[model samples]
Target: MILTTHILSGAALGANIPNPYAVAGLSIVLHFLQDTLPHGDYLNKKSRLREFWKVAVDLAIGLSLVTAIVFYKNWLSDEVFLTNISTGIFFSLFPDFTTFLYRYLNMKFLRPIKDFHEGLHCYENGSRRREFRIENGFWDIFITLASLLFLLFLCAG
Candidate 1:
């Protein structure tokens, strides 16, 4: 997601103020990372609420920066790519659609592959990075390549 946001951050350098792609990418990265990072399940209501608000505020600021850029720079001018409402909507929707598809594929296909591999691996000592066989590496690489191809196809259309 940082990678995706990095692409849009380039927009700011392109004489635009806030970039929708950057905003969405940053929001998704922060939200997903915060949600996934292991933290104590036990927390007071105030602490949990504060944590939630902190992430929320970060997201809002990113989105606001995007809006500020668009309006302040008159990014809808012919010089900007997103010059229409539809284009604006498309930029806003792009990351969410990609994320949904990625998550769907991970749940449907990747999880099964990981589960099968997990069944074969055992650790006498606690260690997370286990080098699997060449076949496993190929499977992982194939999935990523296929995903990239799919994205390219989507962009082409």
Candidate 2:
């Protein structure tokens, strides 16, 4: 899924979960679960440079959207709200960030994580793997918007 969708979904979970530790744990689990679903990703199989630019843009937009939400909701003033939401956002994005490091930095320690992530992906067959595609980009946008709106309603009430 796109980072924006992940962030909004994680933030929604964070807002309702209440417990920081649980929210963090669940956010990580949710990341993998969401990946299994049909969702869009901008990463290209042909060009690493293009993938990097796409990811950079996506992350920048996702972070900006989250920041705007935080300010609009005034969540920073509430310690519990701040902790849960931030933890959720971080943990949800952690898997992908780690995967990037493993791919580029060749981190041996992250091999297990990388393997598990690959296994969780939808296109992971016995010997063949598929690149993530933007065919589902519309779904990503719909889900992100719906999750954000729901979170906003929850916060307001």
Candidate 3:
């Protein structure tokens, strides 16, 4: 499945299908890839990325709620905001929610997936793909290229 978090789907976003549904669908795939990537983040028993992501997510959500209260002046009437959030999460899981479930299951029933993520900033992948499987910026480059193409297509259309 080329569209399965492979980055090329980001390129296809440029095709400009004109149907908001299609664009929305593609965005779902993009977000899934983004969420699945532990690039700027990773998870392990003693995972720094996991810790950071937890704090970041908590802070962001808290800040966003405060901002919403300040901006809207009526948090009680924020049903639309809630709806949009539900939609966002719903759309975000387009490609591989099952994989997430599988990971949970792995940790629940089986053993923790090893070869745990690493901290490889400003360092090379050691002359081998396997060495860098956890920290290869090349994947992000491919994804960026695809996203760029998709944005271009949107502009063209």
Candidate 4:
């Protein structure tokens, strides 16, 4: 799944769930479970600079959207809410962070984490082009919209 989808989904979970620990654990678990769904995998074996730029832009956009939501929902005033949300977002992205460390930084210690992350992907069978297993069109938009709606529902109630 795209970073924006992960961010929004995690934020939605955080916004309503009162238990920070539950939010954190569930966010991480959801990250892998979502990966099992057929979604876009834009990162390819291209130029390192190109991949880095793509990730940076996506992450920037995701975080920016999260920031806007926080302000719009007046979540900043509540420290506990803020912490839970932040934890949700962090854990949700933690797997990808470990992947980056292993792939880009050669952190062999994170090999197991990276393997587990990739093992959950829809096309982990090593057949077909993994990067092109799915296109970045429908699923991204659907998940993003659904998560946004969920967040709005929680906030309104």
* TM-score for each predicted model, relative to the true structure: 0.28, 0.84, 0.32, 0.86
Model 2 ranges with Cα > 4 A deviation: 44-50, 124-134
- TM-score winner between 2 and 4, please give it: 4
Report the number of the highest-lDDT candidate.
4
What lDDT tens digits, residue by residue, belong to model 2 across residues 1-157?
7787788888888888888899989999989998887554556333465458777787788778878888887777888787788888889898988888887776879999988987776663332233344555556777788887887775652
Please list the C-alpha lDDT of all candidates, in the order they appear: 0.36, 0.76, 0.39, 0.77
Output the lDDT of residue 32, model 1.
34
RMSD of 4: 2.5
Q: List runs of model 3 lying over 4 Å from the truth.
A: 1-27, 33-38, 44-82, 93-97, 107-157
**What lDDT is obtained when candidate 4 is compared to the true structure?**
0.77
Stretches of model 1 off by over 4 angstroms after superposition: 1-10, 13-52, 83-157
Ranking by lDDT: 4, 2, 3, 1
Which model, 1 or 3, shows the larger lDDT? 3
Candidate 3 lDDT over 9-93, as tens digits, reads 3323423344445555766655544544433323323333345555455335533433443244443454543343334334433
